[model samples]
Every structure is written in C-alpha cells, then in structure tokens.
Target: MIAVLFAILTAFSNGSASVLQRRAALEVPHTDAVGMSLIGHLLRQKVWLAGIGLVIVAAVCQAVALATGPISVVQPIFVIELPATLLLAGFMMRAPLPRPVWLGVAAVTLGLALGMASAAPGGGSSAVHGAAWVPALILTGLVETLLIAGGLATRGNVRAALLATAAACAYALTAALMKDAMARLDGGGGAGALFTSWQLYATAAAGVGALFLLQNALQAGTLVAVQPCLTLGDALISVLYGVTLFGEDLRTGWWVLPELLALGLIAAGCVELARSPLASGNATAPARARRVD
Candidate 1:
C-alpha cells in the first residue's frame, strides 16, 4: 500500500511535469527539427527547469515504489498520469472541461480500479541475470530505433505518435533497469556500489533517450494525439517488462475478460479525452493568435 501511494505521487509529478514542460517547449522559438540547440533553448526556460525538478521528484518516488513492490504493481499505476495531465492542463488552459471529458475521466478511473483488482499482479524478482539484460537491451534498442526512424519518415500526428511510442518504450526500459538499481540500493550495498551498478547507468541513458524523444513528440504535433499514445504505451509496455523481466504474474483464465473490458474502457476514455477542444488547441487559439498578431 505504501508503494502504491508512492507510485501515485510519481504519477502526479509526471503529469504536472508533462504539462509544464510542454508549455515551455511550445514557448521556444522554432528551430531545427532535432538538435541540441533546441534542448539548450528549453534548458534556459524557468518553467522547463521547474518541470525538470518535478521529474527528479517523480523519479525518486518511482524508485521507491519499485524498491518496495512488484514492478507490475508500480508500473500499471502510471495509467493515472493521463487523467492527471488532462486535469492539470485544463486548468492551465482555463478551459471548462466538457461533459464528455468528465465522463472520460470517470471511465478511466473506474477502468483502472476494476482492471487492477481483477488482474492482481504479484510476485517478481529483482535479481536480474546477465543473460536477461542482453535480450531486453537488444529488443528495446531495435524497437526504439525503428520507432525513431519511422517517426522521422512521417509528418504531423503520425510522427508525434511514433516518437511518443518510442519515448514510452525508452521509459519502460528505464524503469525496468531502475528497479534493479533501486533493489541494489536496498540491499545495503553502500552508495559506491549503487553508483557503480550497470543498471544505474543504463537507466540514466534510457531516461535521456526518452526525454529526447518526448521533446520531439511535443514539437511534432498537438498534445491531443501525442499525450494519449505516450500515456497508454508507457503503461502497457511497463506491464510487459514487469512480467517478462521481473517474473511478475498477471491473472488469467476468466479474469482475462474483465481485464480486456477494462482496457477497452481506458482506451475509449483516452480517445474521448484526446478529442477535447482544449487538447486539440482550438480552445486557446484565439488568445494565441492575438498575441502573435
């Protein structure tokens, strides 16, 4: 339960960070498609720096959650980040969330509750094997490579979706490695050993990759499309990593039906939320245009 609480805190931090960072990123002057200069520009923004601080907090909370609970348990809880982000963004944008948006929020909340209760994921190993890292790293690298390539080949929403998916995959890999690193921290290995762990380095690298992809995604298209794919992809991929790498077990048999139904509800709700005027940028267009004009 404590782990769950920490995970919830992580979700809140992540959602708030996303909104803040996106706002900052949008304020940046248009630049090259993908370059360090773009990142340098964002780094100078106070709002973006604040968002990075929240990201650090979120990472610490996530590490604590992974240390104390099954990765499956901790990761699935990130699904809440979507609704949290929407709520925070709605307030910042000063747009009244429509009735459908409220309904979508309810559906997502109920679905996550029902799904988690039905699935009951538990039992996982943090003692990662050398062989385990090989396949996981290779697969994650290949998939993210493909996603970046595909995203670069496209434009508009398609590019955003691909980049966001890549970012989600990178984040999932980071979390998986982070679980191992955090587990080491709890084993009385001392700070030196923790710093020397390969998992820690891998986690940092993956996190950087995820951040790069995320910025590009935000620049590519509207948040309406990018945010949902990022949210859902991260949650689903994290579950996959938890089960595959951590030896976690998800409920099966008759329980699969309800889990599927719950997932459907989440999907539907996310779609509805993504279509909101606020999300699509229509709600704030007049004000933005006036500022530009």
Candidate 2:
C-alpha cells in the first residue's frame, strides 16, 4: 500500500512538472523547429531546469514505490498522473484552467483507478515467468521506435498526438519494468543479477527515449489533446501488461458491474476534455506567440 501511495505521489508530481516544462519549452522563439529547441543552446534558462529537477524527484519516488508494490498496481498510478498533471499545472502556473481541462483529467484518473480496482490487486493463479520478460522488453522497444518513426512521418496535430502517445506508452512500459526490477531485487537478487538483467535495463532505456520525444511533442501541440491521449496510452498498456505479464486478475461480483460503469464514465470525461477548445490542435499557446520573454 505504501508503494502504491508513493507511486501515486510521483505520478501527480510529474504531471505538474511537465506543464511547467512544456510552458518553458514554448517560451523559445524560432523560425523552425530546430531553432526553437536550439534557442536554449544559444542562451540560458531556469524553468526547464526546474522541470528536470521535478522529473528526477518523480523518478526517485517511482523507484521507491516499485520496490514496494506489484507492477499491476504501480502502472495504474501512471495513469493517475495525467489528471494530476492538470491539477498540478493550475497550482504551479496555469491557474484558472477552463472546465474542460479539469473534466478531461478527472475522466482519465477515474477510468484508470476503477479499471485496476476491477482487476485482482494481488491474487491470481498464473505466475509471471522471469525469462519471458526478455522478449517483452525488446518488443516494447521496437514498438516505441516504430511509433517515433511513424509520428515523424505524419503531419500537424496528428504527429504531435502520436509522439505524445509514444511518450506516455514509454513511461507506462518503464513503470511496468521498474516494478519487475524491484520484484527481482526483493527476491534477494543483487547488482550482479541486474547486470545480467538485459530486460530491465533495456526497458528503462526505451522509457527514457520515449520521454525525450514526448517533451518535443508537448512543445508542438495542445496539452488537451496530448495529455489525455497520452494518458490513454498508459491505461491501455498497464491493462495489457498487468494481465499478461503480472498475473493480475479480474473481479466478478455484484459490485463489479457498477465499478466497470464508473470507469467508462471516467474515460468519457478524459476524452471529451482532451479535444476541447482550450487545448484544441490549432489553439495557440499563450507563451509561444510572444517573441521575447
């Protein structure tokens, strides 16, 4: 439970941090995409640094959480972060967010939490095999690479959405692998165990690379579309990994019916809000329009 709590905290914190990071990224002016990213190299800035600091803190919290919880439990919290990010962003800088943004966040959070609750939090008959993760890790990497390539091949808002989705999927995969890594260590496995652990480290690298592309996507698109779509990626991936790789189960009883309904509502809220005018694909970022800041 403590692990779950920390993972939730980490997700929320990171969500808030990304808003600031994206805003900072938006501040750079450019004649082309490269020029915008290069603006920082040509000068100095602190906000993006602060965003990095938050990511580091989030990572530490996540690491500790994984050490304590099951992967199925840990991954859902990553979904919670999308809603948390909107909430955090308001408190940090973008106060007075339109109702739609809040609505989207709420939907995502509810859907994820309830979906996991519908599953067995702990008990299941099938066990995850240690060796199977090797291929899982490789496959995840290849998928992200394909997404990145595919996103690059697309145009306008669609490309941004694809990339952002890649980022969220990356984080989700990392969260799953991280929980697995922690599980291995708890079983009395040591550093030498991890050194030979190609899967764990490989997933970690893929996650990191995915995040890099996500940051760039944030700079180019509306948060409304990006945040929720990206968030959806986490929920779906967690569900996939949870049942197949982690042995998480589903509950079937009178209460389960309503729980499932509620989750659908949550997803509805998230998707509806994601495409709102406040975060529509063509909407101009407040900070991006200005040449000097």
Candidate 3:
C-alpha cells in the first residue's frame, strides 16, 4: 500500500510541477523554442530548481512503489497526477480556473480514483538484480534516435507535441524502469554485473530522451495544449504496456468500462479547460502567480 500511495503522490506532484513550469514558460513570447526554453529557465530558475528537487523526491517515491506494487497499480497512480496537478496549480499558482475548468478537473480526479480502485493487478519483472548504468544507456538511446528521426520528418506543432508525448512516455516508462533498476541494486548487484540487467538502459534512456522532447514541445506550444496531451498520452502508452505486456493482471470487472469512460471524460474536460485563455499562459489570471514548487 505504501508503494501504491507513493506512486499516486508522484503522479500528482509531477503533473502539478509541469503545470507550473508551463505557466512560467508563458511569461515570454516572440522567442523561438530554444530561446523560450532558455528564457523560461532564467525566469523561473529558483522555482525550476525546486521543481527539480521535487522530481528527485518523486523519483524516490516511484522507485519504492514499483518495488512493492504491480506496474498497473504504479502506473495509474502516476497518471492521476494530471488531476493532482490542477489542484496544486489552483492552490500554489492561483491559476485562474473557470467553472468549466474546475468541472473538467473534477472529472479527471473522479475517473482516476475509480480506475485505481477497481481491480487486482499483479506483475513482476525477470530479475530482481542488475546494473543501473546499462538500462539508462539503452532506453535513452532508443528514444533520442526515434525523435531525431521524427524531427527530421516533421515540423511545426506536430514536431513539438510528438517530442512532448515521447518525453511523457519516457517519463512513465522511466519510473517503472528505474524502479526495476533500483530493485537490482538493492539486492546486492554490483555495477560490474551489467549483462544481467532486464532492460534498464532501454527504459531509463527512453525516459530521459522523452523529457528532452517534452521541453521542445512546451517551447513550441502553449501549456494549455501541451500539458493535457502529454498527460493523456503518457497514461495511454504506459497503461497499455502495463496491462498488455507487464502482466499487471488487473481484473476487469463491472467497473472497468465505466472507469474507462470516466477516464475519457476527464481527459476531454482537461482539454476543454486548456482551450480557454483564462486557463492558458497568455491570459494567466492574477491569482495564478503562486510558484508551484
């Protein structure tokens, strides 16, 4: 249960942090993606640094949860962070949210709560021991390679969101992968035991690479558009892997379809809220000035 709880907290924290960062990014316009990222970095240096620290905390929590719970349990907890984020943004950043936005936020939270509570999910990896460095290297390489190729083929918003979605996917996968990596290290595996890794390098590297793309996406589009897309995209990708591949073993009962329906409602509502200027960076209301760190 500790694992499940922590995963939930991590998801919430990550979403909240992303929302804050997106808002801060909005402070400047007329800048290119690289330029905007740089400026945004400068504008919220202290805040982002705190956020980085929070991410460290989140990483720790995720590692713990993955060790104890099924990937299905863990991943859902992480995905729910989107709603937690909206609440956090409301309190810390004073982000102006309309009634519709609040309703959308409620939908996400409700859907996530139901989804998480509805089933028995079981899962296990091939090994309890391996080298961290190996997985970190491999996953990161794969994601970066994919994006670089995609970037060459695409432009405009597609280019940006694709990177962001990739980054979000990487993040979701990273948590599970890092948890696996940590499991190995804890069980007395030395750094030299590189070959015994399950898929550490692949997952870790993928997660980091995805983060790089997310920054690019944030640079290209408004937080309103990018955040929800990333949130939903991560949920879809990670959960699919968890259920179909990880053998999360979640039992779909009476609530499964309803839960899925709720989840969709929440996602749609979030998108609708994001479309509003008041919920967006360009029109960040006066109340939204609080730092989400």
Candidate 4:
C-alpha cells in the first residue's frame, strides 16, 4: 500500500512536469529543436527548471516505491500518468475537460484498480539472482536494437510508434536495474555496494537512452502515435521483466480474464486521452482554433 501511494505520487509529479515542460518548450523557437541550443534556451526558463526539479522528485519517489514493492506493481501504476497529465493541463489552463476526457480518466482509474486486485502481483525477490541477468540483458538489448532500427527506417507515425516502443523497453529496463540496485541496500550491502553495482550505472544509462528515444518519438509524430505506445508498452514490458527476472508471481488461468479486460480498458482509455487536445500539446491553443475543424 505504501508502495502504491508512492507510485501514484510519482505519476502525479511526472504528469505535472510534462505539462510545465511542454509549456516552456512552446516558448522556444522550433529551429532550436536539434541541438544544444535547445537546452540552452530551456535552461533560461523557470518553468522548465521547475519541471526538471519535479522530475528529480519523481525519480526519488519511484526509487522508494521500487524498493518497497514488486516491480510489476510499481511500474503498472504509471499508466495513470497520461490521465493525470491531461487533468493537470486542464486545471492549469482553466479549460473544462470534455466528456470523453472524463470518461477516459475514469476508465484508467477503474482499470488499474481492477487489474491490481485481480493480478495480485507478489512474491518477487528484491534482488535478481546471478546468471539470470545475462540472458535477460541480451534479449532486451536485441529487442531494443530491432525496434530502434525499425524506427529509423520508417517515417511519420510508424517511426514514432517504433521509437516510443523502444523508449518503453528502455524505461522498463531502467526500473528493473533500479530495483536491483536498491535491493543491495536492503540486503545490508551499504552505500559502497549500491554505488559499485553495475546495475546502478546501467540504470542511469538506460534512463538517458529512454529520454532520447522519447524525444525523437515526439518529434516524429503526434501524441496519438506516441502516447499509447509509451504508456502501455512500458507497463507491459515492466511486468514481463518482473515476472521473468525478479520471479514476481501473478494470477494465471481463470484470473487472466479480468487482467486482459483491465488491460483493454487501460489501452482504450490511453488512446482516448491521447486524442484530446489537452494531452496532445495543444492545451494552449486559442479557443476559436480548438473549436474549429
């Protein structure tokens, strides 16, 4: 329960950061998108800096959640980030959310609750066992490589979806690595062991890689193309990692029905929310423009 609370807090923080950063990004010239000039411009924006600060806070909350709960449980809760972001954007912009947006939010909330209750993910080890990491890392790398290559070969929405999928995989891998590193501390290995673990460094690398892929995805296509893939892919892949690598137990057989239904609802909600102007980076557009075709 404590882990779930922290995960929710993390989602809220990340959602708020996304809205703030998007607002700040809109102030910069589009010509600056490709280089360090973009970062230089953003560094001058207080809104962007606040977003970065929230991102750091989210990371701390995520670390705490992973340390206390199964990765399967902690990571899936991030599916709410989209809904949270839309709601936050609406509140910040003083725009009343449309009916579909509210429905989407309800769907996501209910689906997440139903899924957690039905799946009951538990019995995972805090730390991964030896030799298990070898095959997992190799397979993950191969999958991400294929996704990135496919994304590079494509254009438009196809490129965005593929790149977002790659980013999702990297984010999931980062969470798994973070959990393993945090486990070292729980196991009485101390700060020395935590810093020395390869997983710690790998976590940082994977997180940065994920951020890069996500940025490329955003540039390639609309949120309709990237958001659902990013949200659902991360949750599902993280669950796979938890089950395979961390030995997290989830209900199977008859219980799979509700789990599948929950996933469907979550996916539908994500798609609906992603289509909204609030979630698609158009929250600041003129009301007349929003009302037009």
Candidate 1 overall lDDT versus native: 0.78
Worst 10 residues of 3 by lDDT: 284-293
| lDDT of candidates 1 onward, in order | 0.78, 0.62, 0.60, 0.85
State the lDDT of candidate 4 residue by residue for 1-293, as single tens digits: 88899999998888888778877888899899869999999999999899889888999999999999999999999888878877887887677899999999999899999999999998879999988999999999999999999999999999999998999999999999999999989777799899999999999999889888888988998777887788778988999999999999999999999998998898888778878877766667111101000
- Each candidate structure's TM-score, on Cα atoms with residue i matched to residue i, is 0.82, 0.72, 0.70, 0.91
Candidate 2 per-residue lDDT, tens place, 1-293, comes to: 88778877787667656665666756666543385556654346577777667778887788777667666566566666545655555555535677777776777666666666676565432224757777876877788788789888986677778887777677667766666665555556676665566557855686766668777777766655565556656656766676678776656687678566756766576666555543332333221110000
Candidate 4: regions farther than 4 A off: 26-41, 285-293
TM-score-superior candidate, 1 or 3 = 1
Which has the better TM-score: candidate 3, or candidate 4? 4
Question: With candidate 2 superimposed using the best TM-score fit, by how many Å does residue 167's alpha carbon deviate from the native?
Answer: 5.2
Top-TM-score structure, candidate number: 4
Residue-by-residue lDDT tens digits, candidate 3, 1-293 = 77778877677656655665655555545463475567655555666566666667777677677767766667655545545555566666666566876777677677677666665556655233335436644664686578657855787666666666666667666655655565565567665443477556766665656666666776776665565667666666556556544545665767678767757875676675566555454554311211111
- Residue 176: error of model 4 in Å? 0.2
Ranking, TM-score, top scorer first: 4, 1, 2, 3
Ranking 1 against 2 by lDDT, winner? 1
